[model samples]
Target chain A: MKLTRRMFIQGAAAVTALMAAPRALLAWPEKAFKAGSSDEVMQALFGSADVTESGSVVLNAPDIAENGRVVPISVSSSLDGVENISVIVVENPSPLAASFDLGPGASAAVSTRIKMGKTSNVIAVVKADGKLYSAQKEVKVTIGGCGG
Target chain B: MASDIRIKAKLTGDTAEVKTLMKHDMETGTRKDKKTGETVPAHYITEVKCELNGKLVMTANWGPAVSKNPYFAFTVKGAKAGDVLKVSWVDNKGGGSSAETTLG
Candidate 1:
C-alpha cells in the first residue's frame, strides 16, 4: 500500500466521524436539574432549605465573575466536627450546585468551579455536629457564559 | 482506557496546596450537537476524593453543571513536604480514574 493525499484525507474524515458518534453510559439528575427554584432543588438534594448563617464558614468567591461558565469557588470551615459541605447558587434555575462529604481524617475545605445562569448569591453550607452553618457572597455574572 | 488525571501537591509552609486537572467532557446532556441537532447525553464526574498520607483530606460530589476538563485546587492543613497525596474520581457512567504524587 502506498501513502497518498487521498488516503490522508480519508483517514482524517474517519477520525472526525468517530468523534461525532454519540457516547454511551452515564446518569444525570433529571428531576433535580429540572427543578425551577432553589428551594425545590435543595429539598431534592439535602432535604431542607433552612440554613443558618455563620461566620465560621468562609466562602471565597469573586465579587464580579468575568464569566458565568467557570466561576471559581472555595469553601472552608473552622468549626469542629464538620462532616459535609455544600454549594448553591440561589438565582440559577437549578440552584443546588455541589456537595462534599468529609471524613474524620479529612480537612474541612473544598474548591471547585461552577456555572451560574446569572447574577446570584453563592452559598456555602457546612454540616457540623448535625447542624447546618452557611455563608453567602453575591457574584455578578458577565454576558453569555452559563445557562440561559 | 481510563483517561489520565494530572495532579500536583506542594508544600507551602505547614500546609500542602494541591491542584488537579482531569481530562473529561463533563457533558450536561442539555447541549445539542450542531450537526445532528440532537441532545448530548450527560457524562460527568459525580465524585472526587483526595487523601494525604493515607488519610482522607477531602471529597466532592459534582453534577453536569461543571465545566469541561475540570480543574480543582485546595489546601490540606498540617501537611508537609514528602507526604503522599492521592486523588481519585468516579463519573456518572461508572468510569473512574486516579493519580498520586508526593508533596514536593
Candidate 2:
C-alpha cells in the first residue's frame, strides 16, 4: 500500500501492454454496415447533427424486423436540390456507413438494402447544397444474420 | 458446389422482377482457419446481371463490400407480360450460371 517505485513500474508495463493490443479484438468487426443505433449513427454522420422531429426525410423500414439477417431500407428526402446523402448504422463495427453522391439535376432520393447483423438504428444524413439535414428510425433486429 | 446455382424471375406489364441464388464461399480474404492460422483465399461473387425480356434490366457490381449469400431485388420498366426474364451471376472465381423465367 505504500508508495513504491517498483510496483508503479509494473503497473505501468501492464497498462502499456493492454493498450498495444489490436482494436479489432476489443470490438467485433461490425464495420459500417451493421448500424443499429440511431443516436450513434447521427453522431458519426455529423459529429453533431441538428435533427428535428419531422417527417421530411422518409426512412422506410420495419419498426420491428422479423429477421435480423437482412433488412430493406429506403431514404427519400423532401428538400429541394438535395445534393448528397449518407446512411449510418450506429452500433455496427464501422460507423460512417454508406454515402451517395447526388449531383445537380439528380433525383433527391435513394433506396438500398443493407445487412444489420443485429438491432440497430438506421440514420440518413442529407447534404443539401451547403447544408446538412438528417432523419432517423429505429430498426429492431430479432434474429442475427450475416454470421451475427 | 456449382450444383446449387439458381435464378428465378418474372416479368409483368411495365415491370420486371428477378431473384437469384448462387453457390459460393464468399471468403472476405481476412478470415483464417481456426486451427491452421493460414489466411483463406478470397472467393466471393463480384457481379450480377438480370435481363428482362432479353433487354438488360439491372446490373449489380459487388465487391468485397457485400455479404455472403447475397440476394438482390430490383424492378425495371419496358417488360411486358408473356416475355422472358433471365438472371445470371459471375463470382470472383469466375464461376457463372444462368436461369430464365417466363413473364406472368
Candidate 3:
C-alpha cells in the first residue's frame, strides 16, 4: 500500500480520537474527590440532603491513632436493604475516603484502612431502603496520615 | 501478569469474613511528583466487586481519596468453606485485576 499524507493524517486523527474517548467514560468523581470539606464532598456525592443519625449503623475506629496514615475503620449497619456505605475522614485534604455499594444478599459491613491528615471525625454513611443514615467517631491522630 | 490482590475468607457459621489488600499507588492527582514537580494524575480503584460461586455478593465504589495499597474487608452471609470467592477491582484508568480464593 502506498503511503499518502492524507491517509496518514486521517489515521493519526482517528488514533487521537480513540485515545480521548475513554477518558470521558472514566467514572472518577472529580469534584467529590477533590472537595475540601466533608459537607461539600457529601453534597457532591449524594446531593444536598440530610442524613439521619442511626443507632443501627456502627462506625468503629481507634480513639487515639498513633499513625495517621493507616487508621483502621469499619462500618456495619443492621438496617434492612442496605445499599451503600461510605467512609469519610473529616480533616483530610480530600475528605471523601472510600465508598461501597452492596448488592442484595450482601452483608451490611465494610472494613478498610484510610489515611487521616490529622485528628478528624471519621464518618460512615449508609444508605438503606433509599434512606441515608450515618454514624461518626472522633479519632485523635498524633501524626498526619497523608504526609509526615 | 499476576494480580496484586491478596484475599482471604473464613467461614464461621453462616457468615464468611473476607479480607483483601490491593497493591496500588492510588495517586490523588493533587500531589506533585517529587522529581518533575508536576501534578500526578489521579489514579485509583473506582470499583470493587466480590462474587461468591459466580454470584454477585458485594460491590464497592472508591475514589482517589483512598490510601495507597488499599485494604478492604467485609462479611458475606450464607457463605461456606470451600466456596469460591472472587474479588476484582477496576481503577480509574480502566485497568483491572482480580484474585480468587476458597473460603477456609
TM-score of each: 0.77, 0.50, 0.81
| Tens digit per residue, CA lDDT, model 2, B1-89 | 43465655555556555555655566656557777888877676655656665665544444332445665544545667777777676
Candidate with top lDDT is 3
| lDDT, candidate 3, B1-104, per-residue tens | 33699987778997998999999988776677788888888788988889999998887778665678999999888887788999999988879999999887
Computed on alpha carbons, the lDDT of every model, listed in order, comes to: 0.78, 0.59, 0.84
lDDT of 1 by residue, A67-89 (tens): 88888899999999988787888
lDDT of 3 at A128: 88
Q: Highest DockQ: give the candidate number.
A: 3
Please report, as a residue range, the 10-residue window in candidate 1 chain A with the lowest summed lDDT. A22-31
Candidate 2 lDDT, A56-148, residue by residue in tens: 777787887776545666666878766556666665544444455454423455454555556777777776655677777888888754442
Candidate 1 chain B lowest-lDDT run of ten? B1-10
After TM-score superposition, the amount by which residue A87's alpha carbon in candidate 2 deviates from its true location, in angstroms, is 7.0
Enumerate the candidates' DockQ scores in order.
0.32, 0.06, 0.54
What ordering of candidates by DockQ runs from best to worst? 3, 1, 2
Decide which is better by lDDT, 1 or 2: 1
Candidate 3: which docking quality band? medium
